[model samples]
Target: MSTYKAPLADIRFALFDVLQAETLFSRLGRSEATRDVIDAVLEEGARFNETVLAPLNRIGDEIGCSYDKATGAVTTPPGFREAYAQYVEGGWAGLTAPERFGGQGLPHALGTALKEMIDAANLAWGNFPLLSHGATEALLQHGEPWQQEVFLKPLVDGRWTGTMCLTEPHCGTDLGLLRTRAAPAEDGSYAVSGTKIFITAGEHDLTDNIVHLVLARLPDAPTGSRGISMFIVPKLRVDRDGNVGGANGVRCGAIEHKMGIHGSSTCVLNLDDAQGWLIGQPHKGLAAMFTMMNTARLAVGLQGLGLSDRAYQNALRYARERLQMRSLSGPKFPDRPADPIIVHPDVRRMLLTCKALIEGGRLLGYHASSLLDVIEHGGDDDERAQADALLGFLTPIVKACLTEWGVECTYHALQCFGGHGYIAEHGMEQLARDARITTLYEGTTGIQALDLVGRKIMQLQGAGLKAFLELIEGFCSEHEGNPDLAEFVAPLRDKAGEWQRMTQEIGGRAMADPEEIGAASVDYLFYSGYVALAYWWARSVAAAQTSSQPDAFKDAKLQTARFYYARILPRTLAHKAAIDSGAAPLMALQADRFDA
Candidate 1:
């Protein structure tokens, strides 16, 4: 069986040392997010997850969620409901929500650490509360005051969970093709009818009521996506006075037998004339639903990060204890019958790759969360705008790259165990299976790639990219004279320059041929992600050197950063080459000629 202990030290280092989140929170007037408070939260969060949720991970995976066909209800694995109850009782569900909504009113950046712990501890269990954060965002931004009082408060305080009912039987990514209909009622409510598939946490026993943020179309609306509207449809009807009643035409038709995260119910939700209330204006649902989708995209990225960390921890432990062949050069432990597999160069390479990606990726994800704080609370409008732009640029990259890397890291970790990793008992295969879903859900990597190149980069004129480039340039300029950092700073500066040039080249080509965007998107995203991590790794090395940590810790950071630069950073070159190849090769293959 696998064990999980939250990586609190690395999390704190990324939050305070590398990102200086405490200073940023103070500057943003978030007085409640003091270091002591944040530290205590992290401690309690670690304790709860490690003690409560971690023990249930294997059982959840083994037993999974059971669905009652007659009742259309889901019974989660034995310990899942209890764990969620404890999570709510501990006030963790509202850790970063508004104080007025019975929340603790903490910073989103601080919550990122706790979220990571929960996911790492039990990702299946984590899925239940995950969509609630997204629902809270959608409601706070678009829900009416009465709706907020009825729906958003419970979502925040963890009395009820939330679901984003977006995908339908026929439509996964194409919202314009959806057939869900919302008919207006005389009593100011709407009757929603649709069958939504792959709805996570749609019907769970963890909460009494499930608030579903559903997308549908009104009768007189325009065609396609512009005709869409969002509605709040609860499993059980709730009046404006906040009283819960009987079932409101919402029921679970079926549950998908998935490849991973089985304890988290992936439901087929059938809303048959369910009583619903409009959220935001009609015919503009996609925009409003994006509020929830964007939040889920980032949270999904954390899912990848958490899984990667857990996989790495177990792989490292296995490598240190499992006896294998002696070192290639000579045996360091002559007394032992065989040296540990950690003595092998190839094993070390795998471990180093995991370390580099997990640590650097932590900074990547945390920095994006800090940007949310600035956008919400920053005093200066210009600063807030910059943070928002930077966040927009980083979101797709963070979501796509971290998830793709998660798949890679899990593969490496499983490989470290040799034959044992393939079995069910060792639990490496479970982590690998769970990690697979992150890249596909919220948005596929391909969708994220297109979003980055087409929407964020070309349409927004790469405002986020420009902001990020400035940070790299400024960091390089500040550290150019420091001999200790010259090795990292020089290459980082070079990659930043290359990143800007590549973006311009892609932009120029996209103007002549629009298909170029689709062709260059995935490769361009990978290229940009590598360069971005290069910048963070350099900063991490510098922070480690100057911090009050032990010499061994500093040396480990230095060595790992070197390994990343030498072995991993060169991956950007391949992506750049693919981006430079243009769209010709891909387009040359005629669709009908493939089978010939």
Candidate 2:
């Protein structure tokens, strides 16, 4: 497999060329994310992931995490503790954290790219800290003022890590049905008691302290999701003097033996009167938890982005190096027994699809990250609202679309390896198993689709969603004259418009037939994901042409942009057609449709 190169040219194309990300940085007065700064961060992130993190992946899966039932502590695969110690000592833990809490307060753009590098290098190890970053972000936003001073600094510094304890074994999708409980204590805190399953990073030796954000119902709390509240339950309680104290009440029952991500522990946590403090308003816990959950959903999507990129790199490498059947035209490697696999049309097609999806996803992911940066750092409230509202609608898209395609891209890339892909050492099989959870975890594709069609798109009568569609249309209008891009651009725009019309029709019909949303939700989600990618390709071509830098490298970017549009961008049409019809085809099956 090809070792990661950071894909700097492509990342530069997305930011400086297509999105003019540095311009936004300058305009927003974020002196830190300048072009030089971004380039440096990307370089360092790539090296850290490649050197410190990647080597542990195969070994991690081999040894996996272990639970000591007697002490109820989870131990990660060997070398993880030391790796995490170095990672924290480097001050990388708070790259995106707010400065007030000792964070670097950087924008999401750098974070997004950095995450891709780490995930692609070693997803199993990467998942552990990713959860902490997200959980800390939520606490910083909603935790009490004193709580920030007490907790945020250590978390931001990576001395302490965090986790979200929301999922119960029986209540995976429905937070409203969670049975965890919280009661008042004499010490002005709450005593939390709950059992949470499938908790990633729930128990680990990577940090001195593990802060768990749990969802529990109070004595007088409201019923359902409305009655739930969010609490901060520490594994090892902290004293007022910043001293690490005794175990509170939380313990690991057993770690799950899953098909993938074995390096990271997924625990079933049993909280026996754990010392806890409420993070937000009573019965408003679900809302606050979603803040972290949604953030996680996006992180999960980026996880997929990284997987697809690495998978493509691996497959593309194998295709060229390994000799295969002779080409139709002629044996390109005339002296060899056969020809390079790249000479085959089907091989090229698969390669092209993987590239299109990964690159397209990279574009979309970065754009979303930039929007978040603008929302947080920009001076103008209107600009911030525009950025925030737009990202709010796209988060589900970013999370759902990229992860689903991540799985698809990995499957195709693995197939290119033929029988070799399925083996343990080849590492392709790990990508497949690891990428699968992204869909089911961090909200399933079904839930994300429902969030898109039912909540995000329809909310405010489609104002935020319409704004995004309009943005894509505006780009087409501006770039209509570029002939090289026009061939790919025009058809994509038409298809997008077709999908938009179908969605409008279905959305309007949804008022009378609520089930319509559920029936076509996945199709609609995929349809939007399809056009969103087209928009990325179009922007890429425009930006690559307008690149400020010089010759050889920029030309390569323009070529890759063309490759994406010409060879890979057509998949959107299939999704559009699926969205435009056949809800009945899906519904046509009898009541025993699921009977196996």
Candidate 3:
């Protein structure tokens, strides 16, 4: 196995060349985040992850985390705690946080890039900060001023970690089914009682205290999701003076036994009369939790992105070095006994697939982050509102598409290793295992698909869809006659038009039968994702065509763009066909008929 190295060149190309992030940063009034500062951050982040975290990837997976039922304490694999301390001391947790809250207050666009690097280096270890970032988002958005003063700073500074406790034993996707309860207490606190299962980093030795953002029903709250309220329940109590008190009523009943990401402790949290406080208005906890969830969904997508990148790097290295048989064309390595696997066309297919997905997905993910920067720092309210709408539209696609593609890309990477990939010592299987969960958690692909089709498109009346289509059209129109980009520009415009038409068609059919939405949703989501990636790939080719970079780098970008257009973009056809098929074939079979 090879050590993970951050693809700094491609990252820079995506940020500067494809997305023009520095220009956007300046326009957004983020003067502190100069290109030089951002570059330095990436360099240092790469160094930290490559050295400190990369080496621990295998150990984290092999040894995993150990949990103690007696004390409700979870111990991370070796070096996990010390590594987290180093992360905190380096001020990484505060990178994108507000300066007043002890963060560097950098644009989340840049922070998201740094996050991708960290996740790619060590995903299991990355969960600690990932959850913390989500928790920070919720508090920053909806927490009371005092709550921000106390909880936000600690989490930002990494003195403590956080977890979003939403899923209960009975309810995973349906928040309305949650059985957790929160009752009013005399001291102005609420008595929280609930069991939140599948809580990542819920109980860990990485921090002294764990901040849990739990969703529970209040006494006077309505039924279902509407009745739920968001609560701030700390594992260790804290006073008004920012002092740590004794342990709260929260305990880890058990930890889950999982296939991958074993290093990150996934705990079953028991909140027995736990002292807690509300973050947002009552009966609106679902909305408040979404503040964290939106950020988390994207973060989970990055997990998939990171693992795919890591797997590709390792598999590509192995392919180049591993001697197999003679190439189909000729003997490329005449001096050696046999040619490397890279000489094989089939192997190249796998390598190119991984490369194209990562590079294109990088552009898609980074562009979404830039939109986030616009939301936080845009010049005017209108621009911010537009940015918000665009971000909301892209979130589900970014979360679902990148993750699903991550699984596909990783599978290709592993196949490049052939039989050796299956063995544990090679570390390829672990990537596949870690990737399986990304689509399931943070809202499953099905749920994200539903959100994209039903909520974002239909409910919002295609506000986000229109924004995205306008972006694609603008780009296509800008590059209308350029011979260099003509190949990409034309197809992209056609796809954009088709996407809009498909959206309208689905909306029309859904009006007659609501089941049409669910039936077409997953395919529509995939269709949207493919089209979105095609736009990014075309943008990359356009950037490469006009760049002053070396021929090798520019050629690689153009070639990969071509590969995406030719091989990957066509996958959208199947998705479109599935969407056009509508709800009949799927709904024709009753629930009981599925098993039979």
Which candidate leads in TM-score? 1
lDDT by residue for model 2 over 1-596, one digit each (tens)?
A: 33555677777777777778878888888887777878888788878888888788787888999888898878889988888887887778888888888888878888888888888888888877887877786777787877778888888998888888889989988889999999998877899998999998988888868889999999998778889998988888865445668998999999999989899899999999998988878788877788888788888899999989888988999999889889999889999999989899898878888887887799888888888788777798988888887888788899999999899999998988999999876889988898898888879999999988888767656666777878978888877887867865787678767866887887877787677778778878887787788787777666766676677756655666667666655666676576657467677778876794
**Shift of residue 273 alpha carbon in model 2, Å:** 0.6
Residue 385's lDDT in candidate 1: 98
Checking candidate 1 for backbone clashes, the offending pairs are none
Better of 2 and 3 by lDDT: 3
Candidate 2 residue-pair clash tally: 1
Q: Estimate, for each residue in 324-347, the C-alpha lDDT of model 3 and write its tens digit.
A: 999988999999999999999999
Report the error of model 2 at residue 298, Å: 1.2
* Models ranked on lDDT: 1, 3, 2
Candidate 1 local lDDT, 1-596, one digit each (tens)? 88899998888889988999889988889888889999999999999989999999999999999999999989999989999989999999999999998888899999999988988999999999999999999999998899888887889989999999999989999999999999999989999998999999999899889999999999998888889999999989987888899999999999999999989999999999999989999898887799899899999999999999999999999999999989989997899999999999999999999999999999999999989999999888999999999999999999999999999999999999999999988899999999999999999999999999998999999999999999999999999999999999999998888888999999999899999999999998888888888989999999997787778888989999999999999999999999999999899999999999
Clashing pairs counted in every model: 0, 1, 0
- Which stretches of model 3 miss by more than 4 angstroms? none
Report the error of model 2 at residue 500, Å: 2.6
Where does candidate 3 clash, by residue pair?
none
Please identify model 2 stretches exceeding 4 Å from their true place: 1-3, 239-243, 548-570, 580-596
